[model samples]
Target: MAPQLDPGDLVVRAQRGEPRAVARLISLVENAGPQLRDVAAALAPHTGRAQVVGLTGSPGVGKSTSTSALVGALRKQGKRVGVLAVDPSSPFSGGALLGDRVRMQEHATDDGVFIRSMATRGHLGGLAWSTPQALRVLDAAGCDVVLIETVGVGQSEIDVVSLADTTIVLLAPGMGDGVQAAKAGILEIADVFVVNKADRDGADQTVRDLKYMISLGDRRSPDGAAWTPPILKTVAARGEGVEDVVAAIDSHRDWIDRSGERDRRRLQRAESEIQAITLEQVRARLGDVGGSAALPELAKRVVAGELDPYRAADELIAAVGSG
Candidate 1:
């Protein structure tokens, strides 16, 4: 069991490379305990340095393999890496079902790497609600790079876009990843596209398809300036072309840094994080929004034909404001 470290102690231990403390901090975030605000305050100054990359795609698209291979490549460069993998919820435990640790067993003994699995717990966009908080923990822990691999829940996995500096959309050959990417709105979010399992048939076609999509302006730039995303082929299973993928990622990072896009992205990320936190706080104060005592009473009034729903909403809003 992790020692009972308070928010301050946890931050200090994590900064000193104590993985247990880091994991515990993330656990506190996931549980949405009161300590989180204090933890966030303590972590705020130490963050804003780690290069957070997001990995997302449909299931069976070699996402985990590509992630492990990328980690190996990143480690070879002597980078301290943190991996936050979001997994599907387990029915009974409400924890990560396919535990990412099992897929990334190769790095279990590596001191330079830290991996944690989080259950999505039915949150949409394939991200756990506490992801950004967990990210801050890893960033403050001095990880030079942090990879956020989200749940592969097909097209709705766009939440990573707001959380990562560089988002990699992985797809295997013959999986219709290209077609699915467009349909699922991934085309708008990917910073780098990786055709994993490149040795398989239709790999070239997949690359071509992505190129065609990119040429059609499937990607977005807030400045209206274009960034032609590189479509790299990789055999992540065998480590082939993994370096090229890393090189592409590095290239994108460098571009973002030079083009002043990195800061902009972080600013947007902060805005979104703050907005989400505010909404969560408001809900907590209002006692779960829809399940509040005021809400049920208003429901009763509405059902009894004594008050209209619109008026009830006004009353509920007043109650929330008072609370």
Candidate 2:
């Protein structure tokens, strides 16, 4: 077996580009043990240095292409970029295909850009459990901007909004309902919207629909500033409209800084980290008390109509709470 790694030692090795150490740190974050929590706490001050931008939309809407184009554009401007692509977990095997890297082959040889494909690993609240830690690693590794491409619009998609400083939602012109189907939480979270593949026939109509929907959401910034999310058209494959996207991102950054919402956003992210860590700690402790084993038995009993799930959960909580 590999020797057990001390958190500080792991951090040093990870900083030195040791792939094994980097992998181990990622595992620690995913597991979120007490030791890992301590590591995260220590690493917190080093985070928030990188701009985190989340790109999400319906599948096959060219999100990965857009991400590649954006990263390439940023690189041309001399900014180091990191791309984190979150792939959906397979329903049958619970493993991810992680094929986003294949779509972004242009960066395969670029030293200025780092790309990582992460599995959702059954995390329901939008990101993988280890995503925050992964972002911290990228930030410490000297990435000026980190682009997070989520699995797409679904129940967990809204989680990206809370993680990103500026969330961009992408849409293609010919999608069945166009912008009308995007009126829920997804539309509300976009700091900027991109009608990607503008070469398509209905691109103009799509942009108009998106603008109308955005108008329905609360436009006033929380800090009492006037900040309107702009809708940009893009043909990601041909590298069209990339400059506009970058400009919109810069504009949002400026708005955040000017309105003082940047500090508030940082505080909210810190609170989110605390909650995620606390829940992971509680779950870890529960695991030690046979809660994992007991849960399945209780679930079976409930399915058999021998016990109510609510009462069983109460009993389990009491048992673990006492232990």
Candidate 3:
């Protein structure tokens, strides 16, 4: 079959590392029309090559700048990088309110880097619904490292951890970020903790507090393996201390690889993505029901007190055949 929205050209161009083609492919993923199935099938073989890292934190923690710095660092190592800055969605428009591209303009002209901002769009974990698929697009387009920088919605940042091979939680001095991180359950999910703005008054104190907090709890890896989440400091504005953070991330990656935890985490992520996509398809299929009297009758009976909601829902499910 012919490709969607192309003279059979966009995916080919994207495979060649054309930024415009990559952006268009991501747009198709975000919109996710019927054509996405074709796109996915075509791109499947080229994916699974990129190392995915997630950067998340509360507001004012310098996630955007750190993301930019990471991109630069990775590029300096002769690797291609892609960034997805997930922004808060507007309630009225369901679109990104702030794109964060301004913070990353230093790499705008670099062909080795691709940066985009996405809207949370009311997704539960402060990430875009299409992020996983968008990630595959970046991976297929030849990014060695793909960074998913999520909205700074405190605890909901856990969603990023679920998707990433390595999750970095950024903190700042004087904000009680350590305590807030504990409250957000980040200590449970984070593979690395970053203290950005390290030149500030409470930088060392913040790092100390984080170390103490981790010491107070178990720093064991997810599968009873012995691995610790490192606490690193970064002054992202001056691009200070970011290389150490990157090195820490690389070390964690190496550890996970040696421990076989990387394969396990990727499998879990794939399972979750399958379940989510199935639910989405089921909901969409339900809306396309043409000759469905069981639904309307069940609703009427429930409203008239002829049947209970649970019973009506069961009948509706039976009628829909698990749609």
Candidate 4:
């Protein structure tokens, strides 16, 4: 028989930068292990210190390469980085199909960097269901910065904005991404835009298109302060123009801090997380009610027009609350 794991011991080792312990904690989160509540309680105090940056875009836009390059750049400045690369789930194994851990082999030996490839498991919004909890694990594991690279599921990939402190939208030239971005509503979420593969033809035109689109939108902070998203060009494969991208991120961070937008965003994020958990628990309680005769009895009453759905729903909620 396998031994039971201790959440407090695992958290202590993880905070000491033990990679195995960190990985174990993340695995526990991903699997929704029995000790999840205890682990979360143990990890709560050490979190909220890591700066989370999310990179997202359509496929073929080089998000992984750009993420790898950004990791290298951040490492140069002596930052401990953690990468949560959300990949499409494999049909057979239900694991990450395009494993970023393999693609980012350059940083495999770097102890300052920790990378994990997560399968989306058919979840929408281009991120795995466990991503936020996994992010908390990395944050509590002493990482200075955590980068979340989404699965590049275009049009439905905006959920990263809720989880990240800063969101970077990457685009490549000759892909019609500028107009597509506007249509897909990514222009509103991007704090920094990178026209990657700049050495290719039509790179300048792409930048111009992005700039024109930006001019059409209201790029203001909540406090009415003007904050324009910078359209920078980069050839991430060659590591060119990456430093400028880092500089832009730093500038955006400063702006959000000064404008009090960071607190607002984090508050919204926390509210969303809490709401999701409460809804999930309510759903579980409903499942329990369904197993009893209460749901069927209510359904019969509703079918016979003896009870209205609203009141039935209210009664069901009351039952759930009591249970």
Candidate 5:
């Protein structure tokens, strides 16, 4: 294995556009170990600099295209933007196609723009395992905006709310009953709703359906102010309505700052970090006690009806504690 990088040196080189350095730092963070604590400590001061925005939607909703357009618009305003696109890993191969990269080629050569594609790597939550570390790197590298594009897996995709300052859920026209999408819990977490492919037929119906759903959800701003998540129409392919999307993001940011919700979100994010760290430590200790070796036999016993899953877990815990 490559020796763990010196976090300071990695940050410096990444900011200078050294591809190898950036790749090494990302890999180290993604497959974090004890040394990651040191890296994260060193990176603390660099965080909170980037305005993190998350975009999510069902597959084929033009999330990548919309993100690309949003990045372009931000860059036009003289902002340095970083995009992290999360793609699903194949169950059998554990590899990701990272198709978002293809859609974001417009910014590939822009010095002010940086785009990275990350695999979910079987992480159940909305964020990739290394997301915090990657965000730290981007923040240190002087990005004014960081856009996270999630691998939208419907209701379970609420993880974005924890990872971003603003979360925009994307929708498209003429998708199966629009109500089906709303039922998937996508509406609950949205800071802003986007109706992409607005030029397509039934775009108005999609927007109307989403607004009606929002009304029923008892939506409010983080400060308990009566506010609805605005639904904006967009044609990301042709770059129409992108500016409005950008404006909506700005409006949310202003609201967060003035309403004190920003501080509340920061507190929530800190709590999330604590939980993630606790789980990681527990998992590592379990692995150290050869729990992986016992898993197969325990699973077989459960499948055979000789043991219940709850009992199997208790047994595993006992084995680890005794070992």
Candidate 6:
């Protein structure tokens, strides 16, 4: 068996901006290690400080490039940054296929930046299953900002809006993203819209299309305050227009905080996190009940048409609760 880790020590080191400690803690979270609960408890007090910004778009929208440029901009302001790039999983090895760290090698040696690429590993909604816990690790590790780049899967990827303080949706000039964005209901979730590769043809029309769409949407906060998302053009490869994007993010953050939407959103995020954890625990309990001959008998009864699936599910929950 592996040696037990000292969660307190790790938490302390991570708060001091020790990358290895932060990475180790995130690894424990990803693997669902026995020490995870202890580590989370140790790090809880230091969290809730980092501003999480999520960048998501369909594939080939320069999300990685934009993320790297934004990191550079934030670092210029002397803020420590963390990036979690969620990549599609490789079918063969179940590892992050894109290895975004390689794409962001420019900041690989920067002490103020911590970049990690996590595989979706069959998890839906364009994120790794442990992303929230990993965000906590970075937040507690003294990062002023944490950027989450999703796997860029269409439609289902809107889950990023739940975790990010500000959500940026990127579109390219020729990708027909304006239509896709509407179909995906992304207009509702986006806090900032970026037209990347602005140097390309049709960039002007893309901007115009986005502007027209935004004009029709009711972009308001729960407090009845309006938040018109700023649409900007960028050539991320050249780092042009990134500063404007960053400014828009800062502006949206201020708006959310001032309107009390930040607190409301965080509360909702916590509720979702709690529900997910509770379900996972219940799932584990159901597994235990399944192994104890309960599941096989239920299956047999259902197969014989003596019991409906819904009744079997109710019985399974009761067995899990008792077990």
Pick the winner on TM-score between candidates 1 and 4.
Answer: 4
Number of the top TM-score candidate: 4
Model 1: per-residue lDDT, tens digit, 36-153? Answer: 7888888988998999999888777777777888899999999999988774431112243355446466686788898887655545532536778888999999999998886545
Candidate 2 C-alpha lDDT tens digits along 162-278:
678888888889785455446556776778889998999999999888777767767666767877789999999789999999999999988888887777787887787778767
Show model 3 residue runs off by greater than 4 Å: 1-9, 88-103, 122-128, 152-157, 221-223, 303-311
Give all TM-scores, in the order shown: 0.86, 0.79, 0.87, 0.92, 0.81, 0.89
Q: Could you report the Cα RMSD, in angstroms, for every candidate shown?
A: 3.7, 5.2, 4.0, 3.0, 5.2, 3.4
Question: Candidate 3: lDDT of 40?
Answer: 80
lDDT digits (tens) for residues 154-214 of candidate 5: 4334555457888888888998535656666666678898989999999999988887777
Clashing pairs in 5: none
Error of 2 at 51 (Å): 0.3
**Which 10 successive residues of model 2 have the least lDDT summed?**
89-98
Report how far residue 294 has shifted in candidate 2, in Å: 13
Candidate 4 on 1-323: residue-level lDDT in tens? 44677988998999888898888899888777688899889889988988889888877787878888999999999999998877443111224335544647767678888888765554453253477888999999989989888744553346655588888999999999988888778888899999999999999999999998889888766889878999999999799999999999999898888988888888888887788778877987998998897888899999999999999999999999999
- Candidate 3 lDDT: 0.77
**Order of the predicted models by lDDT, top scorer first:** 6, 4, 1, 3, 5, 2
Expressed as tens digits, the lDDT of each residue in 208-281 for candidate 3 is 99889888887555667777789998988788998998899899999889888889889988888888777776
Instruction: Evaluate model 6: give its lDDT.
Output: 0.83
Estimate, for each residue in 24-89, the C-alpha lDDT of model 6 and write its tens digit.
888888777788899889889998999999988877787887888999999999999998877443
* After superposition, candidate 6 runs with Cα above 4 Å error: 1-3, 89-103, 122-128, 154-156, 298-312
Q: Using lDDT as the measure, name the better of candidate 5 and candidate 6.
A: 6
